[model samples]
Target: MKDKKQLFLSFLMIVVLALMLPMSALGAPGNDAPPDPAYAKWGRIAVQEVKAKYPEDKVVDYLHVGRKTNNQETIETFKLWLEGETKEFGVIIDIHFDTDTEKITNIQFKETSR
Candidate 1:
C-alpha cells in the first residue's frame, strides 16, 4: 500500500508539471529553423505569400518559423517584416502571423525599436 501510494503521488506530481508547462514554449516556435532541408517547400511558400501581400516591402528576417500539430490539423507560427521607409513608406515594420491551414492566422507587429 505504501509503495503504491508513493508511486501514485509521483505520477500525480509529474502530471501536474506537464499540465503547467506552457504550450507556446514547447516548440510552437520552430526550434530548428530554417527547418530541415525537407521542409523547404513550406519555407518558400511562406516567404512568397508574405512577399505577395507586401510587394513593396523587403523580408527583414523571420524566426519561430514552424508549426504545431493539433487535433488532426497543423498550426503554423512565424514572424515576417517589411523595410519601413521614413519618407516613402513612413517607418520600418515587422509583423508575425500564425496559420492553421498552413497560411497566416494571427499577426502582430513591431511598433518601436531601441
Candidate 2:
C-alpha cells in the first residue's frame, strides 16, 4: 500500500508540473520580437488620407509599394484599395516628409482602375 501511494504521488507531481510549465511559458516576455518598420507611420497616414478623400468608400486593402529617399526628403509610397457602393478602385499615395524633422512635406494621391 505504501508503494502504491508513493507511485500515485509521483504521478500527481508530474501532472502538476506539466500544467505549470505552459502557464510559465505564456507569461514570459516577448522581447525578441522585432519592432515596427519606419514606413509604418507613413502607411497609417496614407490610410487616413484615403479615408478623408473618399468617405463614401470603405478601405478594403493596403500595400506598401516602396520608399525613396533623397538628401533631405523621403517619400513613402502606398497603394490602397477602396470599395464603394458603386465600384471598387485603387489609390496610390505618396507621402513626402523631411528626412531629419519627419515633418510632412507633401502628400500626393493618384487613382487607378487596376
* Highest-scoring model, lDDT: 2
What lDDT score goes with residue 24 in model 1?
Answer: 36
lDDT of 1 by residue, 15-107 (tens): 778676645356576544333664455556556766776677766544455656656445444555445443112122222233334454443
Point out the worst 10-residue segment of candidate 2 by lDDT.
26-35
lDDT of all the models against the reference? 0.50, 0.88
Model 1 backbone overlap count: 4
- Please provide, for model 2 over 1-114, each residue's C-alpha lDDT reduced to its tens digit, 9 standing for 90 to 100: 686467558767877997887677667577343468978988989999999999999886788999999999999999998878777789999999999999999999999997
What lDDT score is found at residue 12 in candidate 2?
72
Q: The CA-based lDDT of model 2 is what?
A: 0.88
Model 2: residues >4 Å from true position, as ranges?
1-33
Please state the error at residue 112 of candidate 2 in Å: 0.3
